[model samples]
Target: MFLPTTVEEVERLGWKELDVILVTGDAYVDHPSFGVALIGHYLLSKGYRVGVIAQPDWHSGEDITRLGRPRLFFGISGGNVDSMVANYTASMKKRKTDDYSPGGIGGKRPDRAVIVYSNLVRRFFPKVPIVLGGLEASLRRFAQYDWWSDTLRKSILLDAKADLLVYGMAEKAVLQIAQTLEKTKDITSCHGIPGTVFWTSQRPENGIELPSFEEISQDKSKYAKATALLQFWTDPYRNVLIYQKQDNRYVVQNPPQLPLEQEELDRLYLLDFERRTHPYYARMGTVPALEMIQFSITAVRGCYGMCSFCALTHHQTTHVLSRSIDSIIEEAKMLTKHPDFRGTISDVGGPTANMYNSKCQRRETQGQCKKFCLHPAVCENAKVTHEDYLELLEKVKSVEGVKHLFVSSGIRHDLILMDKDADRIIKKLVDFTPGQLKLAPEHAHPKVLKLMRKPPAELFLEFKRRFESLSKTLSKKRYVIGYFIVAHPGESMHENDYLKKFIQRNLGYHPQQIQIFTPSPGTLSTAMYYTGIDPITGEEVFVERSLKHRNKMKQNVNTNG
Candidate 1:
């Protein structure tokens, strides 16, 4: 069931007021895939009255005050995506569509939604505790580059003046917070808690101080140094408090919360989610984001692929936690009962589709595992297997009413090569993907791939050779389509030019769509873009800053292969 979005609905619940309220930038979708719905369901299961205020008008206080003040706290998020990314394309052109908004319209939410919503709430309910969660807050927990503004900005916590910031999967941390606030009524005294950050007057004696905000702004190396510390300190077992300064106080981030174990992961997916948008949005029109993911089942919560351009590191763990095969089957069975399910499952996957049922075993050592899991080479200790996934798919394919099951999320090429039964897995995967398999090569140059911490470009060529041979032998009509990032850090203009020619000569066609590099906050790539240096080696790298030049690079991919 959808959470109460109006005061009358709250009254219909036979309650005086809600215990928690979630304000988001997206339209209300009460599906487990949507963050607000997942959070609300978790709180409800814990016996707290939860309500949601979604896509409220920031101009006036009417929508903000409609739900009234919650008794405990108000949770804020910029929906599933950062607002700036949703509002604009990488080419700095305005976008006209938003998957999360009603009627697929843009401009439903402000550009910097987290700050705007927090300040709007403060206007009427100055004393209520305001908590920030979701992608925008998690990635911006520390001050980093902001692409939209083209400058380094302070942490989102400082700008929004929130009471607390929860990073990564917030289920475990949020429950602890609810209990603490209920008992102590002290947000400040609630320290040493995992998966959270709060403002402190003085730095803790045990904390690791990042290069002060001023020093990072003055020197590029300092930013890289701070990022190195940030990435290393995210390990929950071997972590120390990390802090950076604002004007007068410091933002203290506690050690990351321990990842949920298998059984725990099972319970989260087993929760009662309506798995669709609230009926109110039906009047406005269907939500594009919900419709796309409604038939999809997420089997994992984290990734080990530490791509510098991706923010999964900040929002999740290197270790993957997948739902049991039985649990996944249960969800598939549930979908079969839904009226809208048309016998085709859009996807059965997560972050990196094949990083399932494995561990790096780096925990055996008592320090952070600093090496990239797939770059250079796959770690020897890393357990790579496809038995679980392959067997699970076979069983899911046999389920009644399942006409076709497609693994839309791309299985990493490197992982496919690592599996023991590569030929069988590759043949079946090729058979399953409807037309083309999405491969994120990012770039075809060795230096660029190193900066990305991805496998060498040669790996893609090898994988393509095997894939085509298998497709021919299996008599399947399948092809490989590449996802390339244009103007990435460490890439000279000549290299990007080479990429276009390389695809044409080898792949025999030009890519129709090209993803332009945008320096989003909290990504190491963004750090590299701002500092003009590699984060790991602290060596200067070439960055294309000219908008005209970058657009030309995008056009090169479009106009030619």
Candidate 2:
């Protein structure tokens, strides 16, 4: 909660008085890379007075009106509302036929019609010039296949009735939109913004004119395939297009940066830390917990681990960069000043947490070599060492408020074990980590592992044994292994059975997590589902995880444990 300041003070900041209000369904204030905080900061930087309405109960219209109405609206989302609705709708059908529902036969509509939090604001205040952006909006920018409904879906712009849709990194696009709205008050005029998409009302009725996406030229084949699937976008009826009104044409702008280079990564981290810290700490009357206690820091912007079943790599791209150790140490110092600051640092890494300063180095002529050179299989490169990472951990642990520092992020076992310096870092992590360590060995079978492009199950077992031994010697807490995607394409019953038996024999039957496989849009798995052939091998496969089967698997795991 923020202290009440006079509206005059807010107006003196050169912000317009109450023209727009940004609403969100996320609980946390600083979501690191995601959520409304980043955009809110960007808007404030552009001289827009914005107030965040976090985690509002959308079931009641009265709850929404408490923040006061606005001339324009911004809604932000974190991919939960849509998942909840899908789960609710599915469960209702399974209920006893004779049971009468008290809330009527209809589902609860969220405050916003679109998945992005911004679009939801438009649902309550229609014709108020709404703008939607975030992960939900970014991924669904163009017509794409939705596995749950087994149909195509249109861009969220049409479905949410938002005036404009911003994709990828929201900072630049959001600032541009705020500046334009403050000047002209017309969203259509701001269509040419680098990372935004909007309907051209003046275009022909048969097909809408879409702005040429810069990425489309670089990756023409991918764009062509994505465009061809446009016709498949449909609602539950599988007839009416999900997003209608403008001709079916959609534009997907080039995201701010596809794969951030080392220098860019450092710049983003430095700038964000500087901008977000002071205001955030001052508003709360203490340093934010995210800075000190438990928060994730992105050491690298994108992931190179192109796991077929994972979405992070597909959307964020498969490039890696490491932030400077100096920047990380400075940020750690800032976290120590929080009033409720915990002694423990939850995580000190990014996407694949343990990957720090690990880059492919290529020797060139004239005795000069490229620093942080990205190789084809960068993780497996010999020169990419973890000495810097070990030094980084040591520096963070030396911070005044930080009593115990732990690495809670995913560990790339193969990368850690391959390099001697990286292995030393892993050894230190295991010996010093406070609580349960988390690692995602997504699958056990070699076939499944290969499909995921992950290291073999044997390697994970080896790492687990090594960690367990180290933990016992150091008297540390137990470790938890995260195994996900039970019914991915090409997974056989025999493979699952073998995996279950392997868990029973090695790590005991009681596993902490077993997540169901969800086929996210724009992944390698989705491509396989569409073409009915494995994208990597072109082999035919079968995916057989129904709701009932997933439930049964959970039950079986519990009973076996």
Best by TM-score: 1
Q: How does each model score on TM-score?
A: 0.97, 0.74
**Residue-by-residue lDDT tens digits, candidate 2, 1-561:** 121123443456555455556654443244345346566655554556666554455656554555566545554554322333323323224222111111122222332335534444556766667777666666666655566666555666666666777655556667777778778877777776655667644433343223233333334343334432331221111222222232434443332322334564455554332223224224423323334324445565545565666655434434455788777877677667645456766778776765566543422111112211222233334344566767788888898878877776666776776665544555687755656677778777777766566677777788888777767776776575756556666666676776677778877656757765666665566655544455544566665547676555544554573
Candidate 1 structure quality by residue, lDDT tens digits, 1-561: 679999999999898999899999999998888888888888888889999999999999999999998988899999898988989988888899999998999989999899999999988899988889999999999888788887778999999988999988898888887888899887765566899989878877877889878888888789888888898877787767899886678988999888887887777777887777787675788899887788888888788788999988879767677889998888889889887889988888888778777666675334348787777888777676787887778788888988888888857888888877888888878867878888988888788888998888778888888888899888887888888998889877788877878787778877865788888778889889988888788888999888888888878866642
- Candidate 2 collision pairs: 75-117, 75-118, 76-117, 76-118, 77-117, 112-120, 152-232, 152-233, 152-234, 153-233
Report the alpha-carbon TM-score of model 1 versus the true structure.
0.97
User: What's the CA RMSD of model 1 in angstroms?
Assistant: 1.5
How far off is residue 18 in model 1, in Å? 0.6
Off by over 4 Å in 1: 364-368
Q: What lDDT score is found at residue 559 in candidate 1?
A: 66
**Whole-model lDDT per candidate:** 0.85, 0.54
